[model samples]
Target: MRTLIPTLLFFVLASHCHGQVERDKALHFLGGNLFGLAGAGIAKQASDGNRIWTFVGSVAGSTLIGLAKETVDAGQRENGWDNDDLAATVLGGVTIGVTIDLFSKKDDKRRLRGRYSKLDLKKKKQFLQPTSEFVVLEGKLPSLNTLGLSNQQFVVE
Candidate 1:
């Protein structure tokens, strides 16, 4: 009975809102990208630069924040829930998250000193020409291995 009243009220309030979902706003795009960048950065720092966790947390956090914004918007008569804004937020979050991960991986060799060495241009050309790709050998750090990426081959095109 207690739960039912709030649920009923929620529906009643929700039913009052009606608006065409707004998209293509500059503010939405900028806010989404910023949110995404912050989300990924925070997650990466908190997780100590673990790739998977950073990506997952970034996307999840951005999406949740977007939804929370929409929930508040839903009650506002001037602006209802905007699916398009949420989509933009999620996209921005994913784009920045993946980009950060890629950049981190590219720079990982420097961080994992002595495990992998620099490849000469000639040798690099040889490897590049044959397969049109080169693999990044992730070092066997105990923590990284726990993430299942240790010694994994990440192809660079």
Candidate 2:
């Protein structure tokens, strides 16, 4: 009975700690998404070469961030069941990040914002837009535009 009490206390503490880490990681991913959005446009604007490099660097940065995220996730997994907090954080961050990129267009930010605002992430296994040409005024979404679609949906892995 004495040993069992201590074991219960230890588990309670461990679970609390794990929950905190998971929450933190989710927030971090959400932040990264916002950062990526802003930086991606600036990178694109610098110069064609610089733009390419920026994207490359951003991808690397994102990968590193994901690694960091997974490490944090492992901790939570060790404690208890997976929670939605992590996904919420990543999605929140990505929404802001992608929006930042979308809004960066000098001429078409307003116009695009109107169309962009109409998009809904709730769709499953679908591309965001049916036709995506001119996502921004001048910028490109080759996949969206060439395919003549706007909204794109993604399958959750």
Q: What are the models' TM-scores?
A: 0.49, 0.30
What's the CA RMSD of model 1 in angstroms? Answer: 20.3
Residue lDDT tens for model 1, 1-157: 9999999998887666423324454455556667776666666555555667767776877787788878998999998998887787777778767776666553453321121124322232533445554435585434545557764565456
Structure candidate 1, residue pairs in collision? none
- Encode model 2's per-residue lDDT on 120-148: one tens digit a residue: 43445754767644454357445654566
Best by lDDT: 1
Poorest lDDT segment (10 consecutive residues) of candidate 1: 111-120
Residue 128's lDDT within candidate 1 is 44
What value of lDDT does candidate 1 attain over all alpha carbons?
A: 0.64
Off by over 4 Å in 1: 1-25, 105-157
Clash counts per candidate, in order, are 0, 19
The lDDT of each candidate is 0.64, 0.50
